[model samples]
Target: MHVFYTPDLGDNEFYSLNEEESKHCAKVLRLSIGDKIQLIDGRGGFFEAEIISAGKRRVDLKILSRQLAYKKQYHFIHIGIAPTKNIDRLSWFLEKCTEIGIDEISTFICDRSERKILKEERLDKIITAAVKQSLKAYHPQLNNAVRYKDFIQQDFTKYNGNLFIAHCEQDSQKLFLGDLAQPNQSYLVLIGPEGDFSSEEITLAKSYGFKPITLGESRLRTETAGVAACFELNYINR
Candidate 1:
């Protein structure tokens, strides 16, 4: 069944697809009246519906069966990383992480960050596409970019034990994230930029109780490290 993003689809029997979705349904997918389709509210709402009307501007459907909390993951994965130099790589990270089951994302500008600017709108579209492709019941939350220092200093009293910072800097005390993260916990892991987080930045994060962790032996790019951390957290919970 073809699935469409319908975040606004609250409790309703009949719904109309917006212009963009309508165009894709009518022209691209060639779906017409009486066709069966699926709709996701991106917040645990999964619905089955049959199209009643189709047009270039709007597609109306009568929702049949509705399922809530469909395939929702148990653990919460929130990754805070610097934006990659090439946005395509960042987009790849976002897509893969969403497919793998991430709950939240935060792009913080680090002291060594090579790319300071980001387009949230574009990133949102990428995440939405990934969610549709992966058929996720929940949408990942994306936070606006903030400075690493400011991001770390915020009240994380909630994630005291689950908080981590993935850095390349040598630290004998550093533990593997896969081994440290416990299941069903809310995790917030920070990743640095191409140049990596500055020593002073690392110190500040530690002072805030963010323990340093290593992703692996091989050095990873900013985007790759973000994805690696995301995958490790998801994998461990699995």
Candidate 2:
């Protein structure tokens, strides 16, 4: 079944698909009235609906049934990474991570970060498409870009989860990400930029109780490292 995203879907019996979604459904997909389709509200609500009016600019769907999907109890994964120089790499990471499973994403600019700005609107669209393509009921929260120092200063206690920063710097007590992430627990992992975090930044993170960890022996790119950390956390929790 083809799935469409409708973040504002609520208790309404009839919902109108937005202009973009309507074009995809009525023109691009050639869907007609009476065709059944799935809709996700991005808040865990999934609806099975039949098209009532296949208008090119405003398709209408009548809800037939609704189901709520919930995430794993006590397991939430949040990844914070420096945006890569190539925006495409970051897009790939967002798509793959959402497909696998990610609760939240935070992009921060580090001292060594090559890219200082991101297209938030485009990134949000990518994430929304990923959610629909992957059949995920919940949409991962994308946080606004901020500086590394300002990001670290946020209230970590609210997460009530373990925090880790992955870096290549030689740490005497560095542990593998897979071994460090505990099951049925929340996690927040930080991935540095292509040039990696500065020594002082790493120290600052350590001072804030962010455990210095290693992804593996092989050094990965910024986006690759973010996806790797996300996968490890999700894998261990599962």
Tens digits of per-residue lDDT for model 2 on 104-130?
999999999999999888999999999
Candidate 2: pairs in clash:
none
- Compute the lDDT for candidate 2: 0.91
- Per-model lDDT: 0.90, 0.91
The parts of candidate 1 lying over 4 Å away from their true place are none
lDDT for predicted candidate 1 compared with the true structure: 0.90
Count of residue pairs whose backbone atoms collide, per candidate: 0, 0
Q: How much does candidate 2 score in TM-score?
A: 0.97
Tens digits of per-residue lDDT for model 1 on 70-128? Answer: 98777888899899989999999999999988989999998777788999999999999
Candidate 1 has its poorest 10 consecutive residues by lDDT at 153-162
Best by lDDT, which number? Answer: 2
